[model samples]
Target: MQRLFNDCIYRIKALGPEDSTKLFLSRAFGSTNGSCPMELEDAMKKVLKKCGGLPLAIVSIGSLLASYNSPESKHMWERVFKSIGSEMESHPTLEGMRQIVIISYDHLPHHLKACMMYLSIFPEDYVIVKERLLMRWIAEGLVAEKRGLTSMEVAEAYFNELVSRSMIDRAADIVNYYDGREETCRVHDMMLEVMVAKSLEANFISLIGGQYEVMPYDRVRRLSIHGGVEASKQSSFKKTAAGRGRRKNINAMNVEHVRSLSVFELEGHKLLNQLGEFTLLRVLDLEDCKVIGKKHMAHVCRMYLLRFLNLRGTTITVLPRELGDLEHLQALDVRLTFLEGLPETVTALENLECLQYSNKKDYISDGPSKTA
Candidate 1:
């Protein structure tokens, strides 16, 4: 195998990288999708020279722009054409994720676009449990109900499409949580930023931080808000549902299963016990909620089912020692704090796998702390 690989490398050197790429594509997608794989190869070929030779770079950017069509979407295109600032390239040959996510957003069918944008509620790199995210999407009416398709099933279908398109990435873990588990998702920050911007432009009320009220509870999932926002970003954001155009009565929700709930802050209210109400919570993130205190967390920590927990920027340094009770904890994203270390009780969580160490770095470790 080594000899064969070496000989092939030698032959590829003779064939050159560009031709080699062509040959590889010719074999991979040949006769699969109507046109020859080179059809995409040729399209990418033009971008390759300009974008250097990074496939991801060219493809990410091209795919992002492939389906852009809207009065609002047109504004973004104008930004590109007007020589607007773009982060679509890392190296001369590398593709920028900003462009890729945006392009992916554009090409989505109207329904799919609504579903994808609804997912922007979570913070960047925040893993979303498939079931929980889908439920919210359904609550927001993003999924079109079909005969024989349960709401959960419909949600999974949407997720599969996004995965197939590479619009959203799947974790390396084989255990992808459908109804909520520690298997949360990690999405790019740029995608969320664009969604927030568009939401603002479209009168979609954003509920990040203590900025907005949970109004018009009816069909409130899509043009909705996240658990909370960052203190740094709070000043730039305001608490307003005006971004969301109309208003309707809060729909009677049965709140069946919940995967993740991130509460940042409660503004001047000074206190909130919202999390304790959640029983099936998988990922509970309250990184910098200025108001919440130990009193509020008395019952919050008892969620033995929790998998991911982020209390990074908050004043409370030491987590409730009871956090050890979570026998299912998998990933914990808490950094830049005064807390000493995890309680020995952490060993109870036999399923504990990835512990996210914050430095703006997303690493997936093996057991306790290995490396991605």
Candidate 2:
């Protein structure tokens, strides 16, 4: 592979001071050329110096400062400068860039912090759908209800803010030409690392797959399952004494308090069979898991506290008749699934606001629903 790809490979060099300044100013003040007011020039120089000529660090810190009103606010500039630890300058490595990203995360508003950390639930390089993420945020109560704006509108604003801050990257290949909005996004690997660290520190989420295979001994509040059945099985048990000891099962971990659960593996149907343990779950995202079928849907119907249920791209042909039991359900996404029609019991969900499906044939035509 190396011999075949040698001619195609190219290394991106770090930006020099002048180019770094231009990039920083463009993100911070929307300047066509790199220019700053005289009063804040010193602080800007110091901030840029800490960025170490890395474009990612420059843009992240620049966009973070942009949130504060007035570029002329030397106090705000100095405040941000102070928030970045002196250790970053001493290190001057990729670790320094990671610190810069963490600083930006630290500056996010409380509500956005929760939403941002929640992004850690997704696997690295995962293409996150905007509407789906917003629904999850709303379900988790991460987005506050504004006086005139719906929860979704509030969530949209949050997503836009995160994008503007360069905390999340828009999926360049996916766009809605009619609306001129990017439909998907992905977190930069570095940013995801910072989010994962923060999520682990706060115990805000527990992940099972990839690099996060060890389950925390504490109560699992929000769980995200990644990888396939084998990965799940591996994460569910731990071996001791040079792999000769009896396997210890993680089923003893308390799960009744888990409020949200997301499964990204195709064989997540096995996990769904245990849904009854998570009685207080508010969000259940099993998107693109094709192995899920009617049997799993039966368990899903029993999640009485569920507010958001995303079964998009599953193989389930029919929703259970008891779907209406989830009176608190706010969003139900069955798009790209084998389901021909929603159960009539869906009409009984009084709080249902967003019902997303792939085809008109899936709708009953008697209630308010949002189609994909």
Candidate 3:
């Protein structure tokens, strides 16, 4: 916290308050060439010259002052009425961009506002993966579901809209499909941080729990539970996984509220034996989890509608013969797992096109490696 504060202070010092203020005005008031008519541009540029080139500093100051009485707007406008020329320069850090985002974010619809801020979980400069982010959003009940589309598909559409408006950035990650659909994506480093921080206050994001929550599991589509032991809180026991994977809240059966489950991140969590029956589950991520016994595999196989399944970095020796049952699966990220062979059942997936990890040591298949 101190480091971040110090960095901000240092950057501020570098800009020097007066010069930074001049920059701020240009970003907020001076018209960018394409944005406004020449008549308006000339006047706006003078206003911006008052604050040098710092965009964010100007946004904060402007937004704060913009909301006051009409008299205040008049006062600021009068100052602009007198000004000079285009003096605002590009900002040195992302703080200014973030401030502009915050200003715009404050104007979004209440729900969309929450959704936008929740994306800050990944590392800065991280290219956002669409499937993974969408799942978290669905699991949180942030979007309404449609009848024909699977929840994962529904989640992805929302992500597209956010990116289209520049609310988020798209990654250059590409997975050229046999059908030629450009289904790959990613987010910028600084923007990712902005989204994660927003998640804290909005509860807009949830992580697939791992041993050391370092990098978020940005792989699944609709719902990811932190698959760790903290998941089974025996000490403060209240509900089990049997009934809709939710609690009755004995006091008010009418107003049922369920605790959001997180995917356990511990290595042993990979060994799925008896998964808690969660009919309400939207995204299930087993990407870096280590232990996966036969029982867990069977339960996972039967999860008919699972949209995203990640077996990446797991120590599974091979896929169970029952691995091909997920007809509704969209993405199967099996990268870096210890599996030697794939069950022919995998061929049953008409929709499975994104299989990764073909260069490992083993293969339990009669045919050539599909991953290669």
Across 1-372, the per-residue lDDT of candidate 3 in tens digits comes to: 012542463343344555554444333444223242344444444444443444443544343333332423454554433332222233334544454455445545576665676554443333445655665566456777799987667677777655543466565554432212334355544445566666643444544332223333232222223333444543344223311232121111211111222333452243233254533333466655667656677777876666556666566777777778777665666655666667888888876645655423444333421110
Error of 3 at 189 (Å): 7.6
Model 1 per-residue lDDT tens digits across residues 252-319: 32223445454433332222444455577665556555555777667667777776666554455456
lDDT of 2 by residue, 270-355 (tens): 56667777789999988777778666777788889999999876677888889999999999988667777888899999999999
- Candidate 3 at 258: error in angstroms? 8.4
Best to worst by TM-score, what's the order? Answer: 2, 3, 1
Between candidates 1 and 2, the lDDT winner? 2
Model 1, stretches more than 4 Å misplaced?
1-41, 54-56, 59-100, 172-182, 205-207, 210-262, 265-372
Say which candidate scores most in TM-score: 2
Candidate 1 residue-wise lDDT at 299: 61
Better of 2 and 3 by lDDT: 2
Winning model by lDDT: 2
